[model samples]
Target: MVYRGPYRVRVEEKDRPVIEHPNDAIVRVTRAAICGSDLHLYHGMMPDTRVGMTFGHEFVGVVDEVGPSVRNVKRGDRVMVPFNVYCGSCFFCARGLFSNCHNVNPNATAVGGIYGYSHTCGGYDGGQSEYVRVPFADVGPSLIPEWMDDDDAVLLTDALATGYFGAQLGDIVEGDVVVVFGAGPVGLYAAKSAWLMGAGRVIVIDHLDYRLEKAASFAHAETYNFAEYDDIVVHMKKITDHLGADVAIDAVGAEADGNLLQHVTATKLKLQGGSPIALNWAIDSVRKGGTISVMGAYGPMFSAVKFGDAMNKGLTLRMNQCPVKRQWPRLFEHVRNGYLKPSDIVTHRIPLEHVAEAYHIFSAKLDGCIKPLIVPSAA
Candidate 1:
């Protein structure tokens, strides 16, 4: 699949992406999913994406090709691709934070490089196609266990890693009450991560009844219908002895729809120009000395945050792009041991030719669309 332009997709023929560099590997994509981040590109939300650039960040595939320098993964091995491809020896990578790598993208406007994104990252295509070229294969790809199925491997790279990172950031511990906002794939995964981290109770919040139900079933987290709950905090407190949650993770990046911009006050207007409500809610919900971990995908920058609110509660705030290279291996072990099952977040699976249709349903949140797994035509 290739992007001709915004809102357009086609199954056109093209040369398969190959291992061009010494650290590269070519993978035959086995399963790929349309991610919420891809929606930003599909809806023209990301600038610099031009025609012919592939568009996908979540995928599980088999190693069909590997560069001579690659040592961790080999041909015929199953692997999951990480979103941010990082050079193993970068200063940031040495610190176990690949998101801030220095060499992955030398020409792009930013340094954090992702595949199928832009010329910044060697202009390499993405995995939406039958095959993809991976850079720094030893660091950017994680080998899936032989026993893991496609669905299980699907999450080893991205969402599941994000969930584990979110839980780690939240400092979730045994007997602590945790609440996750948004109940989307990331939210659901966050809830599951919290549970696996031994949170006493994990509550999921989302307006969609079906999604809330599925979160309960799949993640084993308690679900709350935001539409039906009069006061979400009150409801959560009832379950937690009115102490609020020990940790609250905001999976919804921005405000839902246009509700937060109703009055558009002048004083607040200047500062609230970008992503206002979601950050506020996450900051406000936690109890004294609590933690708030934000795992939602957001743009480059935003307005000033409400430090007063966070400071008053002695809350710890953690927000940054996930360093996937550092987190993927730990998450893979969790999957291999059956301690986490992120594949359960998937609610729909469709063929690659219907990529456009899948986007429509996924974007509109129609028909209980949770995480839709996309199988390419060749698969």
Candidate 2:
């Protein structure tokens, strides 16, 4: 898929990538996901999003070729690539902070290298095509276990890992009440993972009833539509005995609504960074001294957040691009034990040829679309 401009994507023939470095490997993409974050680029929310660029960060594939220095896996190996592109030897990578690797992105001071994100994220082509070039192949691509399902493996590349990371950031203690804003894929996964982290109660907030229903059924959390309440934060305080939740998570970024002026100025008018409604909500809804985990994708620009309120409340704000490869071990165990099924959230399956239609459907929230998988090799 090629980005023609804002709100436009088209599948076009492009030159197959070749190994550019000794650590590179080429993979024949089997499965790829259209992540919600990709919509930022799709809608022109991210900076340096060039035309004719491919947009995808979640994918699983079989290794078709490998550079001489690639020693971990060879041709025909099935692997799931992480979203973050990092060199294993970087200072941050040495500290196990692969997402913050210093050497990967030319714009490393701002953000790390990511697959198919935008020029601000290192300008690497994404995996939306029939094949993708993977750098630092040995460090970033994990071989898919024989017991792992393809759909689950694909989700691990971004969505599941990100959600799990978000939950981890929340630092949920036993019997803690956790509130997650947004009922999207990441939000649902965050709520579900919170239970595993010993959160006694979980509540998910969203404006869409369909997604709220999903939050109930999939995450086993109480659901509330923000539109149904006059003030969702006040309602949250009341539900939590007027003290607010023990932890709050922001899964909806930039495009979050509920504040008309903020949404219009940030999203439509491009005056500020994408809307901060969700982040601000997290700040206001959490109890004093509580934690806030942010997994939402935001632009590099500034947003009008409630930092002062957060400071006064002593809230711990933890956020980062999820290091996809790091969470594989625990997530693998969860899937093997049947505690999670990442593919259960998949609401649509689309061929690469019809990616434009899929994007439109997902962006417009038509047909109850939650997670859409792109089959690149589909006939």
TM-score of each: 0.87, 0.96
Which candidate has the highest lDDT of all? 2
The 0-to-1 C-alpha lDDT of every candidate, in the order given, reads: 0.76, 0.89
lDDT of 2 by residue, 15-95 (tens): 999999998999999999998888877776676778989989999999999999999989999999999999989888988
The TM-score of predicted model 1 comes to 0.87
RMSD in Å for all candidates: 4.1, 2.0
Model 1 C-alpha lDDT per residue in residues 106-218, reported as the tens digit of each score = 76544478777656444657877788888888887877767788887776567777777888899888988888888877788888888778898888888888888888888
Worst 10 residues of 2 by lDDT: 256-265
The parts of candidate 1 lying over 4 Å away from their true place are 107-111, 118-124, 229-242, 255-274, 301-304
Q: Candidate 2: which stretches are off by over 4 Å? A: 256-271
Candidate number achieving the greatest TM-score relative to the actual structure: 2
